[model samples]
Target: MKRNALYAGFFAILSLPVFSADRKPNVLLIVADDLGYGELGIQGYNKDIPTPNIDSIASNGTRFTSGYVSGPYCSPTRAALLTGKYQQRFGHEFNPGPPVAGNEPIGLSLAETTIGDRFRKAGYATGWFGKSHLGNTPEYHPLSRGFDEFYGFLGGAHSYVNAGAESNNPVLRGREIVKDPGYLTEAFAREASAFIERKKDEPWFVYLPFNAVHAPLEVTEKYEKRFSSITDTKRRHFAGLLSSLDDAVGSVLGKIRELKLEEDTLVIFIADNGGPTAQTTSSNGPLRGFKSQTYEGGVRVPFAIQWKGKLPAAKVDDRPVIQIDLLPTALAAAGVEAEADWKLDGVNLLPYIRGEKTEAPHDALYWRFGQQLAIRKGDWKLVKGPEANAARGGTAGKASTAGAQLYNLADDIGEVNDLASKNPEKFKELAAQWDAWNAQLVDPKWLPNRRAGARNRNSAENSAAPASKWKSGDSFEDDQAPQIASRAFTISARVDAAAPSGVILSQGGPQQGYSLHVKDGKLALSVRVAKQLSTVVSTEVLPAGSHQVEAGIAPDGGVTLKVDGKTTGEGKLASLIQKQPGEGLHVGNDGDAAVGEYTAPANFSGSVAEASVTLQ
Candidate 1:
């Protein structure tokens, strides 16, 4: 905790006998998915969750107190992180939900060059492991984006335990669907460590983005037992998931230390976006809003940079720095200068951090998420749209301020008081500045499939309806679905199998939902809450004729799949699908979004004689 002394010691350690390296330093970028600012023990937000390995990055390096991502969601931040430019500039906005038939080029535009491309061009070995939510197509694959080696899924999220053929998003090894390799976070770490060991003698750039602590809240007993004291089941499981991610970070860092690559490597740890606190019980501390909104909790994330003997250690930098800065910072560390034609939005931080430059790295930071937009100049911030009232837990559709809401972030990190009315000039200046920046960006290449129907004003009031019925191809709006306080529910369907595989009934989108479907002749029931999925597959395939298939969820989160009154499969879910699906229920198809990994609208080919959804 002795700040100056620790920093001096770190510099002193650089002069050791192992410090002979005329070669460019290797770059290691680690990104956690939906990680909250309050999760880290070092952050003093959550004392129960221990993240020693992650905290080590802060202890041995400089932690940015006000670090942020360009976007409030997954894909957009990734696009910006890789391109070093605002993703809105290239129309790479919104999560490209399960592939649509004609939306072939729905990913990071090829016109933009990635940081991996720059490192590879400099003759460095580049590998990308874990989530690549940018695009699912071959052209948008990591290999096409400058990474020489790729191992992970192309979509947004995947199952941590079972990432095989049955999974909606299968784990891939350089484009080939491979068998599930134990837990996903561990597998990513193993692959990253192997890459480091193999390329120890060469300069390498490894991008390890672990989709941990996201959703579906699935954790093995190995991790689950660690948080037994946490009585809240949802938060307990989240802690376990976070612990596993921490271990994975330790694994990679262990390899670096074991191989003596720490001094010659620049390791950066950050999250793609803020945690979705409502669904997964992810605590963002006092920050406002969750993912998808332009609030501090949605865009602000834990960020740290470490270069063993190079950068000052155990220091906390409060200056505002964005994830886009990583690209130029890494390039600068790797002895590569980006060309002016690239038009990078990030600035290199080496000079500024080293005391060679005194001015702040960036004069202002900006954000744009759909109708929401915000801009920060020094300590003053101006936010428009729903973000202004998001911290108060208000719905996005609530009355807007018309022009903008202003706040002094330095004085009010929680974004409580709005100073717009009191200081009209500052608010107007920032709002106009945001407008000018917005004018330069292109329209979104594709928009997300927003939830239809009016918001249910009385979601708390349960209707007296006992059951709802549906037939083949019949769909219901989100409001039409039975609203229950508890997560317990039962769904039954009588179907005549006329095709090999298709969805019989489903609710929610890729982020969360549940579906009873047929895949390769087997009846499968998958309940998805966020990124975690609990699927129960029938032991026996359905007959060529009519059959009764039922899926039920108990209050305790136990799932059961029954075929003709006989239980065929069973599983458990740590958390319920609390996030309302954007698209509503579909009897014969999954609608615009998929409940699990299966493609959207995997419409049932046969007739659904009777489908009933009952709240337990």
Candidate 2:
């Protein structure tokens, strides 16, 4: 009788509803890509367009003036945010390329545990909506990395209005590709609101990362009309895109307030990095440079967080904080203990933010983008971009590397004044720190085209720096080496039905015994037939001593192969690969592509990128 009574009492205690005070708050991490700080009304933007939605976040919560991302670029900052560590420490310091033949793998190594992964372990529902450029491969996918649900495009950027422009790569719901008819940004907001509503009962962590304001500017008439008075075409288009994004931000906030989950949720709003002033009419204001540099303009962005009644109301923190800090802070707020073995690089910022701790949260923040490097200690910064076009003559067409530049951010936010001469000792010290940190990184498997410099919304003609002005090293760098060195390669091309479609080999050594191949059309019907040949992509293997291999496209369907500049072999064109009817195919690694595609083939060998076409 006594034992039974005790057991009943314990059960009763466990069943009792834990008050809001006892439960962890839901977390909504809203991130914008390439958003400028001054663009928000609260951030001192004088533009007619109102960002009430984005501003409301700061109005209701704490706004951070010195908020910084681990890196100036997208992928590195994302990696740091997810892992709560300097991405350079893990060799994820640059953007991974497109899905077909990406320069690097999809995501952080399995060794790194993401915030979503941590939240899931803490009995919280984890959801990721919007941009997921972390990684495209199965292993690096959000579903595999602690996120219970994912809805977004896997690639870095996508067209907003160009429906079906990218085949089969439509907006995704979980692992399945779902066609989304609404504008992409608006649709993401809808999905995000729906997610919050659906998971209201449980503790949830929702990551809403918008791809708006990044590139390939797409805007709706509703948004466009708001910016009609603006004369500059690109700026007008950019404003329209941002307007849609602002509304999307508004929608999620409205949903939160409507659900009356304000106090129970922790909402954070930030940009992936600083705005591309040249690309978007959006101004970085007083800040200098744009995305892809380590200056304040690139890594420092608008950051605000709100926890309603729990956190102090309407305060500003001048202290610096990086994206990585959110992880441990979220975990701490949830009353979960970070396993000692987990070894997170970020500290719990709540104590410091709440005035409980007086010390600075971090001693330094580091970044590594290929050979480019930066280290921020206090207000001093050491920045460097590798030598410009070392190999090629300093011709206009050759790839040029921008040499090192150092600045005292405290004095020069524009980076206009290079203080390397004035502060040689400080520069040397920071440079040493950067080099030591960079030396630990794994050499790149493949060099990818720099995302910022490539043809995007921010053309040099329109930008603060002209496209022609950017040197080779400043824009392009060798891609990190791949883990699967011997197994991977890529091909890409801007297809024009009227022009001669040729095979272009982008990576790997030679196609001697191993063949670089592609097929057009779906594999629903025929198997052995030639189906449709795509400028028969082939190349001969280079001799072991040869450092480079060459591939040629003949007027005929077959491709001419060469190893070490010598012609190897010619093979008849055939559709060896097959694709399903709806599936599309791509090959090669990262941009600078050369693969061909035919929408309708008798039998489709769905697109095969980095396919293992072994001779056997």
Candidate 3:
């Protein structure tokens, strides 16, 4: 079917009233971070793990058997869920890094209207509780982005047990940093319950995104005792963490029951993305791959929706439904008409849920994560790059040499069988469709540093320079340079500053790299790995003359910066750059991408006399 026709049909179906015009049901959107598809007992993929509260959501509502998230990671899926559109369309295609000095604008674009905005316009109280990884800037805060009340950490991950003032990730009540309550999960549940209680008299939208089950596997005894029967250490810890999440769900549900608001509330339970099974010991069950890949185990998450008396209960929805659908679904439930200008990619699932439409809600679902690309139409799935093999925890063979693999999910849910050779016609069709769809998407706003074990060739050790004099825009080719390795190294340059600020020496891209640059007349050194940036800038500025600037990386990852012979700044990184940059080093500029927030190729306005790299 044509894309336009499919969308038109959806609009036509959604035009039918799903609820009474006089009453708009309160929306409770609960999203679990890195929740495995097999974690919930309702799925029957794992028998040992008991999730009675989470399972009750499906038992009392409709369980989606093939529920998928738009992205294979957290932030991207949240972006899609918020806008009811594919994140790629708005350039929110990757997880954004925390704000740095130069790179402060990383966040969801303000162009798109969010679900909170829509619901608020339709007369609803909007509250966001838990994780808000969309953005860290003041403008990107949940309160500014349509939510009236916000309480959560702005970054991706946080410690569940201890979120103290000194913690990297701290909990916030609105804009103020508050003391960490007893435990993070329970605190979030308490906040969610309060929001519901505060807005029970009127229509409200509560976006509860729990950071539980993500990482830092810390669990209190309250939940740890429930999973002591599991002998595996990591699995046992994961179970405990999951139990806390279940209790959180139960807390919110219990409140709804107590307030007698069950009939007037629309509750949705889903995972932001699939679990990182290897790291967290969270099982994807029969599915292959984990988070950060295009496989079913990465994107296909546990999803269910419940609305007492309004929708059927104990029904299994075998058709595929995506997180994007929630926006339009909620809007329809609230009796609000969605405008065509929104250009949402999701459909209202009311007709399908009501049994008014027998056809599937979507004709195709697409995913693009860095170099990996996948397209699923009906039961046939075509994947390019390492995702096909990465799901199996193996190195991905070259797609150009091996071609894209085709799999029929109906027969092989784990994606073990390759049907590319047997089904050439289907493979060709899916590939062509994927290409056409990809053509419409803009280049990613920011590309991740790593792609399924592949490192940037330009930043390899061989690409290093022994000694080179560089002009404004000149950059060295990627060679096997010993200094580029993650070890003790020193970079020193003798330069005459013609301009106040510019890059003196740099390697790598936005995701991971090291750069020594002059910013606002101050010498600054920045090292980035896995999107985390740490920098040390000199307290004093360079006085418009020839001077020697040097940066040293200790074996322990401690960084030291010196101007002439004196120490200017010092800091430490827990880890060094792992992936090489696609663009090699620059002596007088940053090359194609900036290591931090500075603009790309921040060309130097000075001349370099001599530059040398020494490795210990």
Per-model RMSD to reference? 9.5, 13.6, 13.0
The sequence of per-residue lDDT tens digits that candidate 3 reaches over residues 1-616 is 6999999999987764344557778999999999989889999978877889989889888999999999999899999999999998877777773122244367888888999999999999999999998877798999999999988999776667656521334688999988857688898999999998877778889999998888757789877788878888778878888989999999999998977788889999999988877557778889888787788888999999999899999999989899999999989998986789889999999889989999999999998775577888999888754434333222222222137778999999989999999988898899888888877887555533112222333435333453334433334434322336566688888878645476788887667778888877888888888878888788888768789888898888888888998998888888767666544566666644568666444555566657767767
Model 2 is weakest, by summed lDDT over 10 consecutive residues, at: 521-530
The runs of at least 3 residues in candidate 3 whose Cα sits more than 4 Å from the true structure, single-residue gaps closed, are: 1-21, 97-104, 165-168, 385-402, 449-455, 458-616
Model 1 whole-model lDDT (C-alpha atoms): 0.79
Query: What lDDT does model 2 reach?
Result: 0.61
Best by TM-score: 1
Q: Point out where model 1 deviates above 4 Å.
A: 1-21, 98-104, 165-168, 385-401, 450-616
TM-score of each: 0.75, 0.69, 0.72
- Residue-level lDDT tens digits of model 1 in 1-616: 6999999999988754343447889999999998987789888899998899999999999899899999988999999999999998987766763122344367888888888888999989999999998876789989999998998988676657766422335788997888857888999999999998888878899999998977757789988899999998778988999999999999999999988889889999999988877657777888887777677888889999999889989988888999999999999998887679889999998876666877778888998765677888889888764534333222223223356678899999988998989998887788777778878887666544322222333544323122445676455545445553346888899987544467888877666778889877888888777667777788878777788889888888888888899988787878667766554677777754567666445656567758977876
Per-residue error for 207 in candidate 1, Å, reads 0.2
